[model samples]
Target: MTGIDPAVRHLTRTAAQMRKKKPMRIMLLAHSYWPEHSPPQRRWTTLIREFRKAGWDIDVVTPVAHFPQGRRRLPRSEAGTPFRGQRGPFGERIKRVPYLRHSGNRHAARLVDQVFSAAMSIPTALMWRKADVVIATAPSLPILVAGYLVARLRGVPLVVEMRDAWPDLARDARLVKGQVKSVVERVVEAIQRRADLVVTVTDGFAQTLRARGVKNVVTVTNGLDLEAVQLLEAPPAERDKLEVLYLGNHGESQRLDVIVKASALVGGDLMHLHMVGHGTRRPDLLKLAGALNAPVTFHPPLYGADLIARYRSADTCVVSLRDDWKSFETTIPSKTYEVLAIGRHMTAIVRGEAARIVTEAGGGDVVAWKPEAVAELWAELARDRGRLTAGLSGRDWVKANADFRQLAVQYMGHLSDLVVAGRSRP
Candidate 1:
């Protein structure tokens, strides 16, 4: 017994051998990555950080960071190199591809950029070490095509992440003009069916995809790294007026005009809405605010302490999705979980899954999307400040349902199951 027990020695050897086994390798294709803090960046960055923590290797195939229009993040020297891999902060191997510069014609230009970048992604991904799986996330549809082709050529299982209600959204928005059945819808659906696993950000969308006969699907809702997100103290209720915040994009999908008109109705003397971030609609919103004389302050997008400062100064955060689009019912703004995690009351202008989340959290009221209804809610909140105390319900909701730590584990299990299943198939 004094001489090292044989069974204990055997167990130790087995443990060492397991540690020496190869870690899972994942090749991720997306429109954005680290150093660019957008919706996709936030979700994937947090998830990828957790994946790296688990000792998995992630290879990112993306184009030069030229998002948010009017701002190209990386310089020419740093960005446009094809087949040249750089290590990210999270240890991800970032392989950069060139992007197409656009004129004022944004929609058509951006599509061209996506197409160009997606084509480049193939060569970039193929040059990297072989991966066990290929994951392609989409709000940018062209990337899905690239992901499919790469996975096929490389002989790997493909995971297609539908971050938004794509084909439905395209039809709803009429992204393709003058056609009942557009090429865009057909391509998206074809890729969806062909993918090994279709992952949706909302359970509602996952259900929709399943109903459409997509074979394999899963739900991995957008979440934050709880430990990284600072929970600020709720604002004091003794103020003479209310301070409302809308910190995300100023896009058509948000229908921010309603929020502006609501603030106008609330009157500058009683309350003010702080609209932050930039988008195609910011200029129009500025003009609308000027015309209406709304008590709205527009700020360019802020990050780090600046962002947290704005959150601390707010009574409620606005999470909006246009109600007219049927597909939007299944969409949840990426900012929803962040607001909940940070314990802010929400003016949730949404329906369906997103509405259910806000109500369930007790952190906010799901108001009707109309300016009159939103204005009424604000007027009521201004009168009854006690309702502004969001309590810990929202934060609690995030911990249970939207924490990336838990969600990442779920993701790992999903990936493991898919990889194993792929290997097991004839």
Candidate 2:
């Protein structure tokens, strides 16, 4: 409330009115939820609330979870546990399903988690009432299975939102091979083919789906929640020293070996590099930091009230993606949108949509994924401090166009079409 502009109040009210007519009974099913060190939950927090204000009833079905480390965290916020004292900004209902926690990067663990999630979810979906639409996200494909079953029982359309191109990710990551991968791949492939509509977060991913011959697919790129991002304002007391931040999962996909080497080249004391969040490669990165003698700090991911202030305080944020062919076409990491909103300059040692967005905004720099390139970019950023001041410019562009409210409007319209098509059937 403190930072919300009075002018936007009218727009919020208008969006709410349109939201009231044919309000959606949306059930978002995902493996990760709030407090899980994931961006989707935070985005969904704003998303669900906005739907509620617009007069829709929103419900979230997610696991009682922890992420990256696979540790189950306590639910201690005022909202309490989802089944009991759940409350938030927009008064949406939250339902938590029992799920097993395990590392996503390890092949054995991935199988275990996926199987367990699918098993637990089958019976768990019975706990909720039938909804108009069932929206499912993937990492563990069980949520899609859960949605399919629920949608079949309720006779509703199923929206499979693919956040990651799984089994593909597993294949790309070399987690499986030959007949084993083939059989599991077919299972996932069949799911995507059968979905009423398959939604992908990137155009590159959408192409992958089209090539596979799936119809009714759409691209809804992960976006900044403008209301939440705009609510963030610069903090008063930034240190004289530069604060370069790497926020989000630190995993193999980031090619952190170069990041660690670049940190060594920069000499940690001159600029502070803060890595926040947990991922498969965190321990290795920490070990690399020790060997390189870099000035780096690590912290757990922020949640609830802490998120806003962290953005306000960041001087510059960094995002890294490993150079790979499939990666370029398959993924747009969530941090890309978060850093854009922080109103800070961003540096990406990545290619694909992530770098394109940064360059188009004229906000930051993109370097080849190499140690020398990373070193050069860091040196360049260090020399041109004034350029950092303009980094927030991209954020302005995002506020006007790439906001979630606009995306939600488009998504709702798409859902209405699907609903109409369903009514016409047989």
The model with the greatest TM-score is 1
Clashes of 2: 1
Instruction: Encode model 1's per-residue lDDT on 345-376: one tens digit a residue.
Output: 89999999899989988879999989999999
Residue-level lDDT tens digits of model 2 in 1-426? 568865356457656656657776887777776655466675566566556766777777766665555656564563134344254457766676555557555657756765676666556656677678888888667677887887777788899988776757767776668898787788778889899999888887788888988898998777877656553444233344556778777776676778778767877545677887777788888998998888788888776567666666666778887777475546777777767776667778777777788788765778788878777777666666665664467777676656787666667667767877887999
Which ranges of candidate 2 are over 4 A from the true structure? 1-17, 76-89, 101-107, 230-242, 303-314
Please list the Cα RMSD from the true structure of every candidate, rounded to 1 decimal place. Answer: 5.5, 4.1
RMSD of 2: 4.1
Model 1 TM-score, all chains together:
0.93
Q: What lDDT does the true structure give each of the candidates?
A: 0.87, 0.71
Candidate 1 residues lying further than 4 Å off, grouped into runs, are 1-22, 75-80, 103-105, 179-181
Work out the TM-score per prediction: 0.93, 0.86
Candidate 1 has an lDDT of 0.87
